[model samples]
Target: MTSATNPATEELTPFPDHTQLPDSDGTFVKNWQEHPQSILLTDSITPILKQLHPEGEYCIGQDLGIYWRLTDPPEKGAEAPDWFYVGNVPPLLDGLTRRSYVLWREFIAPTIVLEFVSGDGTEERDKTPWKGKFWVYEQVIHPAFYGIYEVQKASVEVYELIGGQYQLLSPNERGHYPIPPMGVELGIWQGEYQNTDLPWLRWWDLPGNLLLTGEERAEQERQRAEQEHQRAEQERQRAERLTAQLRALGVEPEA
Candidate 1:
C-alpha cells in the first residue's frame, strides 16, 4: 500500500480508521471463563501498567479486532486476540473510543498478544501461510510476545520473537514465562476469581511475588488496619492494669 500522504499536494489520502473497521465476525464460541479471565489479568496488572506508562499512553484490547490487513469482508484480514497490550498509543484515537485497531492507520503493533484456547488448541498454534492465526501474528502483526493459554489443561505456552522468528520460551525458576519488557512473568495460578475456583492465568513480579488485584490489595489493607487496632487495644489494656497495680501498692499514679 502507498503512503497515506500524497507528496504532490501533501494532502492525506483516503485511509480507513478504527471507525471503519468491523469489530467482530458475529461468532460467539468463547466459554464463560474467557471474559472473566481477561478482566482478572487486566485488573491485577493495571497498577504495574500505570506505573510503566505514567502518562497514560497505553491501550489494552480484550477480544477486540486488530486489523492487520484490509480484506473484502473486512474482518477476514483481522486477528482478534483474547487480550493484547500496546504501549505508547492513546486508549482513544483522537478523542474517540476505538471500535477496532487498524494497523494501517496507526503503525504501532501490540507488545503482547494472548489467545485463550477452549478446545484442543490446534488453531492457536497453526502456522499456515496467511490463513493461520499464529502465522499472522508471527509474520504480519509480529508482537514481541505471543501466548497460548489452555485453561482445561492449566497450561500456558509463551513464544518470543527472536531473529524474525517465534522461539518457544522456557519458564524461569518460578515456573513462569518472563516478559522482560513488562518486568512480569506469566503463569497459571490455582485460585478462585470472580467466584470460580480453577487454575487461572496470572501475572507475577520479577521476584516471583504474585501481583494482587485491586480488591485483593484492599483486603490486605483492611486486615492490616484491624491488626493495628487490636495491638493498640492490647497496649491500652496493659497500661490500665499497670495503673491499677500502682494504685493498689499505695503509690500515687502519675497523671
Candidate 2:
C-alpha cells in the first residue's frame, strides 16, 4: 500500500456519473476448467487489497467488460479481462451494482489486467488492433501492467507500459515479477485452490508473503487458537503436579 495509494484523494477533472454511462453488457460464459481459476485469483487478491485500503475505495473485477471508449451512437467498446483491479474507484457506483467499468466515467484506468490463457489460446493473445485483446489493452485501455498466465505451461508473462508501449518484464531470482506500485508480485503457484487442483496465478507481497484467501486466513487463525489452548492446558497440568507434591509433603497448597 506504500506506492498504491487511493487516487480518489487526488484532485482531477470531474468525470460523468455512472448514470450517464452506457452499459457494456458483458456476459460471462462458464468454462468449468478455466473459469474457476479466474475466480480464485480474484478471490485471493480482493481481500488483501481491501485490507490495505479499509475505506472501501477499490474495485476488483472478474470477467467484467472494461469500457475504454465511447463510439458513434454510443457503442460500448469494452474487453473483459479475466481479472482486473482499479485502485481509488468506488467499489460500487451510487450504491448501485456496476454493469461494466466505464473508463471515462471513472476517470481512471485499471492498474493491472490479467488474462488466463484458455485451452485454445486464440483470444487471450489476440493482437488484431480493433478486435484483438492485446491491442485493446495496450492502446485503448492502457493499464499500467498486463499479465498473461498459461496454466498448462505453468508460466506467466508480465508487461509494463513503458512510454506507451508494453515492455516485457523479467522475473526476479524467485521467478516472480515485482509490481512496485501495488506493493506485490505476480507469480505462478502450484496447489489446490477452491477445491480445484491446478497451477494458478497468485499475488505476493514485497516481502515474499503469499496473499491468503478468506478460507486460508480462517484456517490460520484456528491453528493459532489451538496452539494457545494446548499451551494453557500444559501449564495447568504442571501446576496440578506441583500442588500434589506439596500436599504429599503435608504443606497445604493454596488453591
Best by lDDT: 1
CA shift at 83, candidate 1, in angstroms?
0.4
Clashes of each: 0, 0
* Each prediction's whole-model lDDT (CA): 0.92, 0.81
lDDT of 2: 0.81
- Mark the 10 consecutive residues where model 1 has the least summed lDDT: 5-14
| Native-to-model Cα distance after best TM-score fit, residue 81 in candidate 1, in Å | 0.4
Pull out the clashing pairs in model 2: none
Worst 10 residues of 2 by lDDT: 21-30
Query: Residue 31 of model 1: what lDDT?
Result: 83
Which model scores highest in TM-score?
1
Candidate 1 at residue 85, lDDT? Answer: 94
Candidate 2: misplaced stretches above 4 Å?
A: 1-30, 33-35, 70-76, 246-255
List the candidate 1 regions with Cα displacement exceeding 4 Å.
1-13
Put down candidate 2 lDDT per residue, 174-250, tens digits, no spaces: 88999987888999888988677777888898889898877888999999999999999999999999999999999
Work out the TM-score per prediction. 0.93, 0.81
